[model samples]
Target: MINLKEIKNDLPAGIVVFLVAVPLCLGIAMASGAPLFSGIIAGIVGGIVVTLISGSQLGVSGPAAGLAVIVLQAIQGLGSYEVFLSAVVLAGAIQLALGFLKAGSIGYYFPTSVIKGMLSGIGVIIILKQIPHAFGYDSNYEGDVHFVQPSGGTTFSELFNAFNYITPGAILISGLSLAILIFWDQVLTKKHKVFQVIQGPLVVVVLGIVLNVVFANGFPQFALAASQLVELPVASSLNGFVQQFTLPDFSRVFTYDVLFLAGTIAIVASLETLLCLEATDKLDPYKRISPANKELVAQGVGNMVSGMIGGLPLTQVIVRSSANIQSGGRTKLSALIHGLLILCCVLLVPQVLNMIPLSSLAAILIVVGYKLAKPALFLGMYRSGWNQFLPFVVTVIAIVLTDLLTGIGIGMAVAIVNILRNNYKVSHYLYKDEKSITRDKYRMLLAEQISFLNKGNILQTLRKVPENVDLEIDLSKSAYIDPDVRELIEDFKETAVTKNINLTIKEIDRTTAPTDEKALL
Candidate 1:
């Protein structure tokens, strides 16, 4: 049920995603040491194949930067790129199994604060990664997300080096492109439908080409080198294009090592896809939730196809999805069209695409990054209180200092601590009744869930009961109680008799209390 009417917006958004995805696909592939065409294959399959199968309307998938290191290490360990592809194929099958088995429900366990932090952290990373490209330093590939670079410098060091190798041409293109994009998105699109249809990014990509031509002819100093532009593996003929597709070595697919690698890939790829899918849903303006299990099936199929015909492992990528959302994409049609556009343009006129300056794309991405990590988002999170704000800020900082997965793990830990701390108060009601004070009586009402985590607070409350007092421990509201909690209550019952305090345990769900004491009232 593709909404044909939304094509007006989808078509333009598709074009924008295509523009943003091109170098990323190539860069991620190159970073992973896989053939450049493999990345394109993954991108095309993920966009077209996964879009048709996935329930996510706004999510876009392709070769993920997160998997670059894994792919690189796996390829080296497996002894060949073909062998690694076999693992990718098996990995996809495992993902399909996971989807059917409903393992995707793991996504629901992620706290909201952590998810928000992931989005903001990624947004921060995008800005940091692209700043060098925006400043005309193309030494770091566009898809490199790691803080420690394989190219021999840290993220900050790259930024420092970018300034030294500053290209006047890159500066002009990125600076002007950013200005025009801001004007187009903020002003022009609002003013006219024609401006809306003709997106700011597309305009700047074209402008970059035209400007580079002008620089080459009249101002050589301002002309970017081939290194500073989009680099695609130009396939001259149908045969040449066909030559890029590499088949996996199926002979080793069933081996122990290969199977182990496949399982690892399945777990990592599925986790990354689930995370990105979660993040993408948060960014969607329609507030529509994508079916997570079905999304796993789609990603599984995409990876299988990618591995079958020479492509890196793919996942639901947040950066491209964010780009699509920001570009007004309303349906999967945008992703499908982006795939079609990549296939057609790469086969037909790759050289023309190669002309579009990296600086221009950098500008577009930097703006997207800014939108995700907006200052207002920080203020809003802060107002949400320490529970939400701490994780959000920690996620952003950790992501910048480390990488995506590590940062998320750290944020999740922080979020869980906050949850437990809040639970300490609300898990049980420990208030002394005013009416009971005169009679040396007290009441404690338990929460619906009384886990072992609630034991500490409940113990303190229990110890506060004085000698010669009547205390009522109410478990009527409790649906579940940890054994540790029950034991604690049992221990308290013994002490109550020694202190000459009358104790009553009401509404216990258990059929039998300890044989030593009839504690239940």
Candidate 2:
């Protein structure tokens, strides 16, 4: 049975995410050089449309920041945004194919260390990119590239520029919103159950909107222009709005550029969705497992709807999912509600939403960035072991130095190098006591397929046997014997003879192992 308590509980978080998503949807579309409404439409479709089909309870789908670079490049390369939309539709179809094939198990192939590295890298990137915006620098874009110059020199230069030319209204709203968000948590921490359940961010967003309304009388608080707000395409009637939908250019569906674009979208979007699902599952208090294949299908449907309506590509975004989980979401219903909220706002309250200060949203993202890239996160990764630590640090450094995909690739390479250096291979060993060895002295068993790295441990364990102990070494189970282990065993046997230790050797030659045995290995 569906639990109404769980649905009601998600309202606070869902509303907070809605506030957070508003400016982000607009900003991401602006950064991608797409129509501003496209991002909002994507968010709505991702939330409402995808939620119906998704197996993930907490995951919230929306336009992704990672796709901004690709979308921008596709538009430029295709010489038209409409052509890019055609590619998006084809990409959606491809994603559908991937879902039906149940290809999500591929996500499991990523080592835990690599996935942790990726999460930390994204966290660091979020913090770095949002710094300027938090300080009232909306000149460039919200999710700007790490190294790319923003018409200025560097990221720091643009940040410095914002401080020099700060807008008072933005500064006021940002400071107020940040203070409210921070202090709300502190107060809630001290309060009893009822207040604790009420999230501070939700209150801050509602207050921010209300404050804008109260101060709208000839005040600069409502001064955000169309450039800062989500700009919906104006139509004469509801029918005209429906008529504004984009259709795929089937003529070029199989063109080389379209195919490449489709592949790019499918691959990257799949990675992001899977990663978000894994992370969200880790974050789930109840430890719920999301179905990856179903998620892909849901996202495919969302993207198909988005692309057809001039919206950006969609994915299961960690940012919204984290907020959803933190806010107390227990099922997909919260996502559906949030999407309806976006649609309602777009249809009825676009004017009032236009007054929301960019700096206020920046402040919200700043807090989110802090939560993701906190000092605790670094310390936690450090404690997880060098296998995890190296990749986590490398991913963060690479992303901060380059971009997302490039950084992930470098981290994966580093992880593979570590795996190779450690000689990660499987082996099995069996010990036996033969009648001859029992009548004699010491006996030791060695298995085939043993690599050189296991030499020290295996040798040390065998060396503890007493001189009179009988030993029977069996190699029948081994399929391959490394020269190193063979030499070590030979030396040990010679030493056993001098010590009066009984040594019996048996060899088993087989081309392949038994099926059950192979599975154990």
Q: Which candidate is the best by TM-score?
A: 1
lDDT of 1 at 233: 94
Q: Which ten residues in a row have the lowest lDDT in candidate 1?
A: 512-521
What pairs collide in candidate 2?
441-469, 441-470, 441-502, 442-469, 442-471, 442-502, 443-470, 443-471, 449-480, 476-508
Give the per-residue lDDT of model 1 (tens digit) for 185-295. Answer: 889988999998889999999998899999999999999999999999998799999999999999888999899989988998899899999999999999999999999
Candidate 2 TM-score, true structure as reference: 0.81
Candidate 1: C-alpha lDDT: 0.91
Off by over 4 Å in 2: 1-3, 149-153, 193-198, 210-240, 424-521
Candidate 1 runs further than 4 Å off: 508-521
Model 2 per-residue lDDT tens digits across residues 1-521: 22457755777667777877777787788889887778888989987889888888888999988889889889889887777887788788888889899998877666666666666666666666665655556676655555566464765566667778665655666778889878766676477667656777766656656655555656855444444433445555667656656665567778899889988998899888888888778777888888899888888888888887788998888777877776678777777778988888777666666656566666677777666667887898899889788987887788667766677778888988887556433343434345543354433445445777767766776677667666777777676678887888889888888767677777764445466667698
